[model samples]
Target: MFALLCQLASAFVGAVIPVFYSYKTIKKPSQKSLSYWSKYWTVFGSFLAVDAVLSTLFINYFIPFYEFGKLIFLIWAVCPQTAGAQFVFDKMLAPFIHRHERKMDLYVERMLDSVFTNGPTLALMVN
Candidate 1:
C-alpha cells in the first residue's frame, strides 16, 4: 500500500515537472490562461497513470508471460510511459535562462532531489 502511494506520488510529480518548467521559462504562460496547461498535463497524467496501473496488473497477474513478454511490454507500455515522464524532466534544461526566469530555485532543487530519491528508492523497493 505504501509502495503504491510512493509510486503514484512520484509519477504525479514527475509528470508535472515539465509543465511547470515550460510555463516558467520557455513560453512564460500566463497563469490566468492556463487552460491548455491544465489539459496538457491532464492528458499526460492520465496516459501515464493508466499505463502504470495496467503494467502493474499485467506484471503481477501474469508472471510467466511477463518474462517472455518483456520486449512487447517495453514497446507497448514502458517506452511511451517513460517518454511522458522524461518530457516532464527535460523542459527547463537549456542555455541562457536567467535566475528570475527560473521561477524558484527551491522547486528546481526539489525536483532534482526527487530524481535521486526515486532512483535508489525504486531500486530498493523492487529488489
Candidate 2:
C-alpha cells in the first residue's frame, strides 16, 4: 500500500505537468505560446496512459500467465513505467511548477490587495 501510495502521488505529480505548464506559460507575458510546456505535458501524459493500459492488459489479458505474468511485467514494464513517471516530473513538471507558482503569487497579491483595502475600511465604519 505504501508503494501504491507513492506511485499514485508520483503519478498525480506527473499529471500536474500540463496544468503547471498551462499556468507558467500563461503567467509570464514574454513567454507566451511556448511549446515547452505542452510538448512535455503531452509526453508525460502519454507515457502514463500507455503504461497503465499496458499494465492492465498484461494483468488481465493473459489470465493463464497469472502471477508469472506479473513477474515478467515487474521486470520489463513496472520499473520503466514508474521511472517514466519520475522522468516526466523531473524533466517536465518542475519547469512548469515555477510558472504556476508565479500565477499563485499573482492571485495572492490580488487577494491581499483586496483585503488590505477593504478590511480596514470596513473595520473603521463598524467602529
Candidate 3:
C-alpha cells in the first residue's frame, strides 16, 4: 500500500512538472515559441532519457530493491504521458496563469523598480 501510494505520487508529479514548464514558457497560438512537435518531444524525450538512465543505473542495478515495481513506476512516470500532462496544463493551469499574468507582471515590475531605483539609491536622487 505504501509503495503503491508512492508510485502514484511520483507518477503524478512526473506528469505535472513538464506540463507546468510548457504552460509557463510557451506563448499562445499566435505567438507560439515552440512548434507542437518540438515542445512535446523536447519535454518528453528529455524526461524519458533522464528517467531511463537513472532507472537503469540506480533503480534497476545499484540499489536493487523493489526493482520490478520501480521500473513499472518509471514507465508510468515517463512514457507518452506528456500528452495528458499537456492537456491538463491547457485545460486547467493555463487559464489560471493567463488570468493572473498581468498582475504578476506588474508585481515583478514594481519589485525590480524598488530594487534598482529606491533604497540606498534614495541618496543618489539627482533632481
RMSD of each: 15.2, 14.3, 12.6
Residue-wise lDDT of candidate 2 within 17-123, one digit each (tens)?
34664676678734424544454555556655766887777753445544343334333322334444345556766677666988978999999999998999999
CA RMSD (A), model 1: 15.2
Q: Which ten residues in a row have the lowest lDDT in candidate 2?
A: 69-78
Error of 3 at 123 (Å): 17
What is residue 63's positional error in candidate 1, in angstroms? Answer: 14
Ranking by TM-score: 2, 3, 1
Question: Could you say which candidate leads in TM-score?
Answer: 2
Which is the winner by TM-score between candidate 1 and candidate 2?
A: 2
Tens digit per residue, CA lDDT, model 1, 1-127: 5445545554445445544655574476675335434534544555556667877777535564433343342233223345532343245322213435466577899888998979888899899
Residue 81 CA displacement from its true place in model 1, Å: 20
Which portions of model 1 show Cα errors greater than 4 Å?
1-17, 25-27, 31-33, 59-127
TM-score of 1: 0.27
- Give the runs in model 3 whose Cα sits over 4 Å from its true position: 1-78, 117-127
Score candidate 2 by TM-score against the native. 0.37
